[model samples]
Target: MAQGSSSPGDDAGNLDKTFREWQDDGSSEVATLGGVYGGANGVNHMVLNVRDMEKSHDFWTRVMRLEHCGTQGGPGQPRFLRFYRSHGHTHHDIALSPAKDPDSLPIPTGPLQTPGLNHFAWTYPDLETWKQQVRHVVDTGYPIQFRMEHGMSQSLYVRDPDGTVVEMMYEFPEERWNENIEAALEYRRVLDIDNDPDYFDPKPEDMPLFDENGLAEAS
Candidate 1:
């Protein structure tokens, strides 16, 4: 196993053995290229270059619910800000940098629309918190992209001032976590709300798993 790899059968002693074998296979060379493994194991924070630092900062802290955690510099240095969730151990969960000119950024091209970061997800502790998040989005009059229930999680997608998608969600009850994986694969479901305006009023519900014909009953 790699340093951060996981397997269903992994256990204390077995995991140590796996890591030793993996390290001896010449695969760990690149990871330890700069003295030690620098390969990403999990998300730490995401920094975005935005049109206006103050605007992005306000949106992230006030509306998106991240707390202003720390600051640097007095005036001349590059403007930067760090934010973290109140209950999280990480010093910062999100950061921002000012872009000299956001309008001059090149537009993506082609039918496939090229490649870019589509969205990032933030999880709520539970369903009640998820509902509060939905209400806050509605209260702020933010543009909602859609709502989805993936059996494992319930989500709300909203657009920020910069038109970047932000996904807010909460994991479904633990009882539903063990649902049949085959059912999910066979009958995928999603709520199409691109046109409906009242989609955010009531809380969303998980749609039934797809049927043999690949369709779910309308709520």
Candidate 2:
């Protein structure tokens, strides 16, 4: 533990041995940490800026199939906001309004649309049900930016009307990544939209273990 001394940080043999032991033990032998539950429940609603409300409505309603609850600016309400799933799914799953000077903003062009915000994910009940939505996107002629098999979920990176990357995905069971979440997070595999309808077909194994900073060497 002394300075300039041989330590785990300056060592590779110990780390490699542990990693190999993990691989030999199979996926079930993962380490986990129990956490204290806070009073927080979960994400209830969100509001975002859109280029066009009608176009956004088409994308969210038709593609995502979110139910439109109602909008503000009716009679007493002075706000012009379109609300989706105001109560059932959550207090308000999403609310949209037009963006101010949208043309002046930098266009979202990244695979995951990284400019202001990267992406936001919506969960599907299961993989099969999610696949149906993927097919719907294809049939609707929407472009799928990226298909990924993440350690915790299989996801489709897609564009909303404003070109924001909206991720539709379903998470794998806890047993898949309950242990060693960091290593599990590093597990990523590209999936084909056509051939890999169900990315979990073969299932992923041999998750890569990166150092805390994801350095090439175990620095």
Candidate 3:
């Protein structure tokens, strides 16, 4: 009959045509049958609770060098501070809210060897930019915990005013990621104080006199 069309006895031909059309649609109906939601497409934003809204805002904007969106609050009410990276156009990357008792959250006293939120990592374009941030952290006297090679990424960890750990990282090439992640996990598992030794112990020399941009003089 017509090219690629089904005839009365051509059931196999019709099935092949139907299967091809399904494949062309790009989404797999059969694969989605398990009801699994896909991974996140990207990071939208994150919110954090802090004790002093003003202090937290200053730390993020002045020290961390994030762009301050604004502050919102009324008399006798808790305040909220919104911030985003200079390159970000969305609402905000982070929001800080005032909590009643800030000190209640237990600060991580020892090295990060256990399972939990280790830190939130942000990527940098290159090593130079990362080192500039390192210099800023050193100058500002921010409590830097460690500088580490995670195989997939090189990272620096620091604690914010509210005791939240933040990470700055430069991701390695895509092909190396899986091996790096595996290596990082193994490193964490086998880490020992006497064996590997700690690289980042906060000291007076490690503290920076300026903020991240190396502009503002720390007080």
Query: Which candidate leads the pack in TM-score?
Result: 2
Off by over 4 Å in 3: 1-39, 103-106, 111-116, 178-181, 184-219
Q: Rate the local accuracy (lDDT) of all candidates.
A: 0.62, 0.66, 0.57
TM-score of each: 0.65, 0.68, 0.60
lDDT of 2 by residue, 1-219 (tens): 111214535333344454455557674444221221121246677888877778899888988888898887742244678889723646579999777667886656655434356778998776677777777877888877888877677787888878778898867766566655776687788987568645434333332234444412211
In TM-score terms, candidate 3 sits at 0.60
Q: Give the CA lDDT, 0 to 100, for residue 79 in model 3.
A: 61
How many angstroms is residue 36 displaced in model 3 relative to the true structure, after the best TM-score fit? Answer: 11
Tens digits of per-residue lDDT for model 3, 35-131: 2222124677787877777777777776678887755674257564555564556567787776667678665666656576666877777666766
Clashing pairs in 1: 187-210
Point out the higher-scoring one by TM-score: 1 or 2. Answer: 2
Q: How far is candidate 1 from the true structure (C-alpha RMSD, Å)?
A: 6.7
Superior candidate under lDDT, 2 versus 3? 2
Pick by TM-score: 1 or 3, better one: 1
Candidate 1, which segments miss by more than 4 Å at Cα?
1-41, 74-76, 86-88, 106-112, 178-219
